[model samples]
Target: MLAILYVSHGSRVAEGVRQANHFLKQCMDQINVPIQQICYLELVRPDIQEGISRCIKHGADCVIVQPILLLSAGHDKRDIPDEIEKARAVYPNVRFIYGRPFGVDDSIIDILVERIHEKHSGSVQNDSILIVGRGSSDLETPRAFSRICAMLAKRGISPVSVCYMAAAKPLLKEGLELAVEQGPGKVYIVPYLLFSGILMRTIRKSIETSVNRFSFVLCKPLGYHPSLIHLLRKRIRESIDYDRLSAQS
Candidate 1:
């Protein structure tokens, strides 16, 4: 059996656990193959270490560490790899595979497009789409949103802007103000969040109370979508296959 450790950008908020557990269960249902375990990175129970131990105990010949992050930032580039290394040392016999992030993948684009269409289906030209993410100071973090902007531009979507919620300049309200200044007939705000919690609720309320003529719709987060599962499966499968090839060599 194979163990898929879906590592998330853990949050202390209780909602984070509920969201992660929900997605993991959905993934379990989608994938018929035996899964050794599912785990988080931090700020919650069943950290990566414990998840790996469970996988080992469950007889995982090879373990795939899949990051549930959107981009290759500090956590993806540094923290996750470090944890995987430690896990590998702990389970010497089991081959440990690290998966790539969900970066500019087709599935992601599909989700974005769906969100835009869903929110502004009939009247797209007037409304500007704002792609908002949990802001990061890391340079790589902004690049992810930039890529999304580029994708939207290519699709001929006008008046689209990118902004962060924290740790970056031009926060959500500022971004909305810019969108208004840009003279978009209507403004649509999309939360680039993985799950709903206090932050999401606050943002939604802010949009609803202060704004007029601007329609703000909260498209659901990437919740147990088949494409996400496919991305995970591909990453895990590649790692396992590569290890097999290397062993044969």
Candidate 2:
């Protein structure tokens, strides 16, 4: 039997855990093979250590650590792998495979395009889009945002720009201001968040109260999308394939 650990960036916000768990369950239910356990990395209940132990107890002969991050950065590239190393040591008999982050994949782009169409089907007046993300000091974070911008462009709507909520600039509000200056009658503030939480609510509030309130439309965060599950499964399979090739070598 195989165990899959879906790791996420820890958040102090309670809703963050709920969102991840919800999606984990949804994906696990759909997968043909069983998922032995699901766990978090930090800032929430049942950390990675606890999760790994549960997998071992559940008869997981092999473990796959699937990061729920969008890009390879500090957490995806470094921290998560380090933790997996520690987990592997504790569960010596268990073969562990670490998967890639969900980067600028086609499935994700499809989801984003669907979101844009759903939000503005009736009113997509060449409106400027402001793709918002939880900014990271990691360079890949902004690059991910840019990739999304290019994806949107393929659907006939290039974003006015990408902005961060916390780390990089222009901040969400500043991005909105820029959209206003661009003279678009409507501006969509699309959150590149995985879930709805306090920060998302705050973003909505800010958009509602902005000086250009009349032109802004708020889209929901990405949640429980099947496309996301496909992305995860692909990464898991890729990791398995890579490990197999390494063994043969």
Candidate 3:
């Protein structure tokens, strides 16, 4: 049997975890695979190892490992691969196919527009857009973020900029400070996160303490969207013959 295992960046916030679970379940329902399981990389129970065990118990001979992330960052390139390699050692007979994360997509950008418009739908001519991302050490991470900024600009959303929460340049505080100082444009703070959690609270707290607290508007994080389901389905299809191996080997 073929099973699909989704590994998401788990959260310490119970509500965040719940949202992740609910989103993945909805994604699973759309995929035709017989057995599908969801697990977290950290801060939650039933980690990657246990998720695979459950898949095996369900009689899965082949498991497609899908990453539920926004970027191809440390987790995608290292942590998840390390865990999957360990699983390969234990389940030598099972075929493992690793899938990709939802990289830059226009549909996602559309959703971002939705998020941006949700807070302040007024004229953006003099207004600026600030994208707050959960930064990653991976070199590709910022490049991808920059592309998002450019795409936003292409859509005529000008004067857009980005800041990171960790592991990258222009930390959120500095970004917020700069946004407060620059060009007299109201900065629309768009969190480039998947779900709501600690970071969301942190963003709120930072804004409250920042200079000209009312000068900024916070938009929703990129959360449960139908396009993500379509993205996952597309990625899973791409892993059709990826990393195939005979279980008996």
Each model's lDDT: 0.74, 0.78, 0.88
lDDT of 1 at 65: 84
Candidate 2: pairs in clash: none
Best by lDDT: 3
Kindly list the per-residue Cα lDDT of model 2 for residues 133-196, writing each as its tens digit: 8787888788777777887777677654787888778887888888877765687777887878
Residue 183, candidate 1: alpha-carbon lDDT = 64
Better of 1 and 2 by lDDT: 2
Residues 110-179, model 1: lDDT tens digits: 7777777776677577667777788878998777778778877777776678877888878877876676
Return model 1's CA RMSD, one decimal.
2.5
Q: What digit string (tens of lDDT, one per residue) describes model 3 on residues 1-249?
A: 999999988888999998888889888888888999998899887999999999999999989999999989899999999999999999999988889999998978998888988986777888889999999888998899889989988887878888999999899999988876767878999999888899999999999998778899899999878788888788888876454433334
Ranking by TM-score: 3, 2, 1
For candidate 2, the 10 contiguous residues with the lowest summed lDDT are 30-39
TM-score quality measure for candidate 1: 0.86
TM-score per model over all chains: 0.86, 0.89, 0.94
- Residue pairs that clash (backbone atoms under 3 angstroms), model 3: 93-247
A best-first ranking of the candidates according to their lDDT comes to: 3, 2, 1
**lDDT for 55 (candidate 2):** 80
